[model samples]
Target chain A: MQFDVRLFALYRERAGASIVTIDLPEGASAGDLTAAVRADYPRLAPPEVRIVVAVNAEYADDDQLLQPGDEVCLIPPVSGGC
Target chain B: MIILTDEPLDPVAVTDSVRRDGNGAVVTFLGTTRDNFGGKEVTRLEYEAYDVMAIKKLQEVRDTLRADYGIEDIAIAHRTGRVDVGHISLVVAVASPHRVQAFEACHEAVNRIKTIVPIWKKEWFADGSRWVACEDHEFADEAEHAHAHAERHAVAAGD
Candidate 1:
């Protein structure tokens, strides 16, 4: 299955594109997608820094399953002033 | 109803939407564009959003607050496009039978909106413009990891 993943904020800048489509196995979890992302984008791999993910616009756990048409978004920490 | 508009936000209208006869306590919070952020002089602030997702997420926030606090009435409005300094950017109004619930719900609503909403804001400073929350990308990445893991296992099990 192929899923459209969105990158925002710093990730978007680093990725140089707002969205990317990646091919995954039929049943891929959010973690698998993260690994795939790290594999695809070495800049986003672990140990350097962590990135947050939102599946279908809501925060999803690493164990959460994704549907084909689900909107997967990568949100960086907000730097807004309170 | 959840509102996503380019027009300036109105706190009074948002407050009115949450006003209920049975609820004695109403708490309203308005988020505005400040003149400065982290020592930078902000000339203006620009907000952008995936409107469809933003509205859906806003509605989810409203529903969650209602369920968690038993708040019958709530309203959340966020502004898009350019907003001048001191202008309202977001408004959240929540009503409950008691003051505590109203206050708690209102705070949670705002916090969740900031954390989960798809809207993005760019602060145009005198020197440069920066996207808010550009550094923290771990939350969404983790979510994606979890979702992918779930899908993989499900496929293995043929479910």
Candidate 2:
């Protein structure tokens, strides 16, 4: 299965690609995809960084099941407004 | 009027969006780029947002205000791209029949935007630049959050 993971903020800067697709084995969880990306883009963040992945615009659990073409997003710590 | 614009945000237009016959009180809040942070001379601020999700969160903020305060005519405009010092970057406008609800709702709306919206603020000073935290008050590279975000949420889930 292929997972389209969207990147933002620091991840975007480090990965240099806003959206990257990861190929995973069948029945891999969201956590598995996150680990794959962390391995692929080791420089995306320091070793201490563990990125949260969102599925279909909402934060998803590590064990959440995958679906084809689900809108997945990486959320960075956000600070906005007055 | 929940929006994220790269152009200069117009306070008057956003305020105008919420005006209606029954609304007597219109409360508007403008967030401007400041020239200083931690007493350091700052140049300009760059703002970014996750457009689709940000709008969804803005709508959620609008719904919360309507349900909690019974105010429907509410508008929020946020600026993206580069915002100069002394320029308006955020506008929260709310119209209500009573002055109190307008004030209260508008106040809560700004807070919600800060809390929920996936908007990031980066400040540039003469020496360097850093991303500001919404509530954590940490000086670490705000952008560095990409790496630690999942772990942070793990702690949040535990809390």
Q: Which one is best on lDDT?
A: 2
Q: Residue B137 lDDT in model 1?
A: 31
For model 1, residues A14-68, the per-residue Cα lDDT tens digits are 6888897888997898878878887888774343344556787666777888788
* B15 Cα displacement, candidate 2 (Å): 1.0
**Candidate 2 lDDT tens digits, B44-102:** 99988888888888889899889999778999999888899999989999999989999
- Which candidate's DockQ is highest? 2
Predicted structure with the largest TM-score when compared to the true one: 2
What is the C-alpha lDDT profile of model 1 across B11-117, one tens digit per residue? 89889987878989988888887787555578998877766777887889899888898778999989888899999888888888889998998888887787566
Clashes of each: 38, 2
Q: What is residue B104's positional error in candidate 1, in angstroms? A: 3.2
Off by over 4 Å in 1: A44-48, A78-82, B134-159
- What is residue B71's positional error in candidate 2, in angstroms? 1.4
Model 2 misses residue B82 by how many Å? 0.6
Candidate no. 1 TM-score: 0.75
Provide DockQ values for all models, in the order shown: 0.14, 0.54
